[model samples]
Target: MVSLIRAIRDHTDEISCCAFSQSALVTGSADKTLRVYSTADFKEFPFSPLTGHGYGVHRCCFSSCGSYLLSCSTDGSIIVWSSETGELLSAVEHPGRSPLRVCALAPDSCLLLAGACDGTVALWDFPSKTLRRCAAASEASIVACSFSPCSQVFVTGCTHGDLKLWDDHISLLLAQKDAHDLGVTCCSFAPHFKIEDSCVELRLASCGQDSLLKIWIVSQREGTAWTMMLLHILTGQTAPVLSCAFSADGELVVSGSVDKSVTVYDANLGTLLHILKQHDRYVTAVALSPAFGLMATGSMDRSVNVWKIGDGYEETEAESQQAPCQGRKLPGHSRLLLADWTEEDVQSWLCEEGLDELVMIFKTNNIDGSEVNHMSKETVAELGIESVGLRGRLLRKIEALKAEQSGSEAPDEFLCPITRELMKDPVIAADGYSYERESIESWIRGKNKTSPMTNLPLRTTLLTPNRSLKMAITRWKSSQ
Candidate 1:
């Protein structure tokens, strides 16, 4: 059973979109503003209520690494913001003169696709900061869009009950299928999973006003062609299904509907697992935290509910025991823990004195201590540690304790600002910060040449490898 942990009554109007990241929860609203809440305290950011959209904000998304946020509004603009500071970074003008309804970021974070009210899909290249292509995806307005885990393919849902597949780079149509009886409301791509033979299979989930959820198996055929086959059609919602999401491990699917209920399903077999009737009004958005087994739902009742799906919601032991080992594997992120530490150790560490809030933030955002150590100073402050001196002291103490218990700590300067991880390959950005080579390069190429840490305009795109930092990290790892 999933129990509601808390209800956040922050929005004054209907919540239209909600996105989760390692640090925060962001929601777009018919109130025409975006509200940001700390994952730890569920307290609104000091800089909450980001405003600029002249109309309702329709969608909100976080970049793959959680350093940036993208939001589309009915005013025909897509605004990018620094996730850490809640400051507006840039606004991309909509290609068509119609309200934008849906948008998606590629897994690589290098490409962006936006579906507008005029039935046009616009493709943008982050590196060049230019609109590369725009094409009509349907005769009717688009409702939902998602990119596959591999970032090679994307799917778009239209108001005409059509689902279209497109190639990632060229925005070329690969296939189209009439998917729903009424307008399709939401679509999501399952996380990548491997088969017994080490082959990968791509799956897509979609929901619609017809009150049904459909799963499709996507595969590439020989000679540059693709195929989609219906795998399952789930039914139970008494009203229109508004949103759907696949668990990070691709083992489950969750959907929210106008019936004021949230439903969880076994992704592989389409078996009904649980129905949570907690909302009083239509549920507009639903999100799952793969790392924490937490789910969030936003509703037209002007409330957001957070639920904990811990051991109480797990499948029966007999069921799991009957499954193959390969079939039972979880996502890598969910399994990450400190070396030589048990689950109890993690829980104890999280409950340590004065660290309760930090722990909640970590769990809600699906982050851990290791990742927190790499966060930029600005991000650390935004997490509720306001004082710079206090923040520095806390970080140092945490590092010392980790070192005393685990092993040598990576030098703070050796961490990447964008990924909040120890730099595997350090590179110096124009802003003078040392970041992981690939992370910084991706940010530069995918986020319109802006610095992730400083949020300043980059003087140049060229990045110089930081050999000294790389050597230092290598030495630290070797000593450990």
Candidate 2:
């Protein structure tokens, strides 16, 4: 279970976007000011409320090392800020100076990308602040973008509902059309990849105006060609899904919706874990800290809420055995994801929903949760539902079910091997497992000097920052 830690109501206008560095959080607003906060205490970072954009700010991001923070604005510029000092480092303008809608930094800290409302993409050399390529990527507005784990290719999603892959040079590699109906609001790539015999596979999470969150399997084979396959389609929010992100390890996914809700899910099983409702208006942005177990959600209500999602690890026996729905259990098939229910489950659901009269008809037609999700007015008529009012009522219920997640692991890397708690600051000792920095430091100070996991003499009393694990903890702390 997750709990809200705080709700920060500082921005005076609607929050357009928010992002997390390993140690800090930054939010951009329609008020044209960007505020920064220390992850250590959630207090305003020194020199915060950066006033650089001439117009509304849309999006922001931090480099992998948290050295630089970037923000794009309707002012048609992407400004770079020194992460440590909040000083303006550089300003790069989008081609044609059209209002910039989105921006992303490659994980390598080598490249910067900015998407303009004019349907063009500007790729810049981050280290030098020089424009590398400017090209047209879509006919509709480019609103979402992310670099692949390899940093050789990037993906961009537009308001036209198309997702495209481009090489670092901004050359088109592949394109998937209508990946989302209506339009795409956000897309994110997991931080790491898996190696198979000949292909490197990665996971991607994308949400859109269709009010659905989708997972994609993107792989590269032969080191030349690429393929993208749909992995799962998650419907967990009632309104347009405005933002989404993959946990650093890519095990869990989170999304924010215009329905003023935040939803978390098991990335692998696509099971609903929890639905949190606290924002008074649309949740416009969501971010998770890498190793800090922090999640921040920004909303149109001018508030940003922080949460503590357990480090992404598999659940314990007790947690896994807990009832799916707390307080009261679902009567039957309602406990399953709508697409996984069987015929018997559907029959039980109908009976529990006070539609027992339709059980025989549904059973006769082999209708289940999957079938229910595909129901339209025509499909209902085909089911021999004669009453218009009853048919309409069933459709409404089906729609409502789509937005609910029932409940759902943490990866071990985020836990301190000594304290067995989610590490606030993770560090890697010679033992090969990450542990809380304070716990390890204390162990080194003791006489034993033994590895916590191995009970062997420590190779050395030194610990290095587990930067990757920290990124994992930050990716899914969600709000409301």
Candidate 3:
């Protein structure tokens, strides 16, 4: 992807908006200042700070034609400004909470939408600069709001998992089915679709601490009401979903997460397409370039990453040269009964099975002589095994037989303690440790093996790849 890490003037506070236009990039900051940087040279333009908002500016957006700019602030004022000059055209005030969460300028009209923490969406006419309309939700802090392309309709999600839709005349309740167990953090409409004559198919995407990305299709009915249907539910991250945006084409939706990855999903299939994994902190915001097919992501890591997505997909060094089967495998267990066996395909398995964890043990020939000697000595020391983990004369005899099979470099050694083999395929184990089959066998083969008979509890694996091993361990500990 085209990298655009231009070093512009840095803000001491959080940057709430990076409004990009053909001529300039306007950024609103909590530092109570708006900086206009030239898009060509990444140089800051000299302008006086617009000083109306009593608190920090929270959101800023430019009109589609790039002729006007709109800013919402904690100062309870929504200010309209001219892009050419730094002149403040007008400031509209409301009696709600401070620091609006989102400010949206209509795509094809001279209308502006601002959502505040008081569950209110206030609409204003930019040309007349007057409060044209207002709508109140069910008494929950509004977290996000957006206007449709034609500026005929707008949507807002609140702190109470409620989704409210509004037009110029009346407030319409769209879908408020507990959209998130937690408060809704962000909401946006598809960027590609047009709001035209017949019927406009609007896709509403919402994310929150509930760790789910819900896609809904809201169709404007013949009358004043609209119907909403749940299109898809995406569950892949454990951390809170921070922000989401539709690609210009509307075929793809990119979501940022506290899980520290920007996940791109096919808006059609709702399947994950790619994971951008360079961020080292919680990703709070994301924007897709309209002209360059580039992605800009901002995070708590205090750095922004600009990546090219399509043909420019790049792989990390480890991923590029990784062997197809670099990990090791374990032999099937003989002493223990079938830990897991598949009678039917995975999907046919009952949902009640959920995911289970299993530990397995196997025997294998040692690769190097020194390595075998070290392992054997350690096993004997830790387990008090005459050979590996057995004691007494009969066990000694069994050890001698095992030794006979083992060459100078451990030829055929029975994996000790008869731990349940970490099966790679989903199977029911003698112990109830069940989960999606992973390379636990591979991990065991290369490490100091632990005793299968030990009272150590089975660890539960997280269902998402975005979760770290630390999270897995913590979850496991908490469950115990």
After superposition on all CA atoms, what RMSD does each candidate show versus the true structure?
Answer: 19.5, 23.4, 20.7
Candidate 3, 127-224: lDDT as tens digits: 78778876676466666887766677777887777777777553675667578877788888886554566666788788987988889888864555
Worst 10 residues of 2 by lDDT: 321-330
Sort the predicted structures by TM-score, highest score first. 2, 1, 3
Candidate 2 has an lDDT of 0.80
The parts of candidate 1 lying over 4 Å away from their true place are 170-173, 193-200, 222-224, 311-480
Worst lDDT run of 10 residues, candidate 3, spans 354-363
Candidate order, lDDT descending:
2, 1, 3
- Cα deviation at 19, candidate 2, in Å, is 1.2
lDDT of 2 by residue, 1-480 (tens): 675655577775678899888889999887788999887667898799898886678899999999899999866799999989999989999767766789999989889998876688999998898899999999778889999888888999998899998999999988999999788999999888988888888899999999999999998887678889998999988899999997776778999999989999999999989898767689999998887667788887778877768744233332332222222212342224778877766665564455657778997998877888788988999989898888888777777666543331234455565544567898888877788898777656544355644444578888899888787787744411
Better model by lDDT, 2 or 3? 2
Q: Give the whole-model CA lDDT for all candidates, comma-separated.
A: 0.74, 0.80, 0.57
Clashes of 2: 20
What is candidate 3's CA lDDT for residue 256? 87
List the lowest-lDDT window of 10 residues for candidate 1: 326-335
Candidates 1 and 2, the one with greater TM-score: 2
TM-score of each: 0.64, 0.65, 0.60
Best by lDDT: 2
